[model samples]
Target: MTMAENGTDTAAPQEGEQQQIQMQILAQYIRDMSFENIVAQKGLHGGEVTPEIQVQIGLDARKRPVENQYEVILKFNIESKNKDSEDKMFLMEIEYGGIFHVAGVPEDQLHPFLLIECPRHLFPYVRRIVADATHDGGFPQLNLEPVDFVQLYRQQAAAQQQAAAQSAQA
Candidate 1:
């Protein structure tokens, strides 16, 4: 029988024989960040200008094939607007990234590990960055609440499954 039917490749390294499966963080950094005080002066006075602050968070990951590494990026967007009007007070966006040297982790679990755990590890720093950026922008220090990445991941998975089921039914 040919090697194709036997599920063995003679031409390259096998997945089973790959090196030790350990995940290590090689580096962490701020990939990009932006803070804009739309009304720089109007929002500077600090007594009681109530603004509704809305924050959005997102996560992404990719493989660095050259070094068998993975990069996880956490995105945070915080926007503040006047409580009664539609005027924007301040908007801040921060993209935090970490380069992880990953080995020995199974392909089945890799996605979750990267999306959930990696960002969970990097969130505090990103949160501080957001706070600092806002404080420097003439606003009160913005403190972010803890993020539940596992819950977010579960929601995404459920949404995907629901979409697939709908399409299949149609």
Candidate 2:
């Protein structure tokens, strides 16, 4: 057991060629983007005051017809409304997608890789889109906080397990 130059252990080849692990981004694009400033003048003035902004994040992965290829999408739904009034300030929605080539990753690691690692690679771009959309919509730049996809995935897994357990007991 010896450490490789990159700090990962490199095992001597046993009987066959070593496994290849690769994840490559073929392309990345904004699938959909919409920004609406509902109230023009009022919203602009109201925007001066702090608005209540809500953001939602979603991730999806689907296998492509091509072998070892998958499409990963990061979706965002952001809305801001006047803090003191019921009037709407602005609404923005974005869907950012990337085509990834994944190879040599085991089946057990596939789902986690797609959901956690793939999205981790795609999040910064999505965050920038949200900020730009808000700024273009005549509001102060709305910089979204960094997301913790690993924690989110764990929570989702726990919820699914609980639901399955409840169904089995029913």
Point to the candidate with the largest TM-score. Answer: 2
Checking candidate 1 for backbone clashes, the offending pairs are 21-103, 21-104, 22-103
Mind giving the per-residue lDDT tens digits that candidate 2 earns over 18-137? 467899999999999888888784434533565899888888899999999999998889888778775678888999999999997888889988989999898888888888878887
**Full-model lDDT, candidate 1:** 0.84
The CA-based lDDT of model 2 is what? Answer: 0.86
What is the TM-score of each predicted model, taking all chains together?
Answer: 0.77, 0.81
Q: Tell me the deviation in Å of residue 39 in model 1.
A: 2.2
lDDT of each prediction vs. the true structure? 0.84, 0.86
Instruction: List, residue by residue over 27-119, the lDDT tens digit for candidate 1.
Output: 999888888898865644444567899998888899988666899999888899988666789988888999998766778988988888888
lDDT of 1 at 132: 85
Runs off by more than 4 Å, candidate 2:
1-20, 41-48, 165-170
Quote model 2's TM-score: 0.81
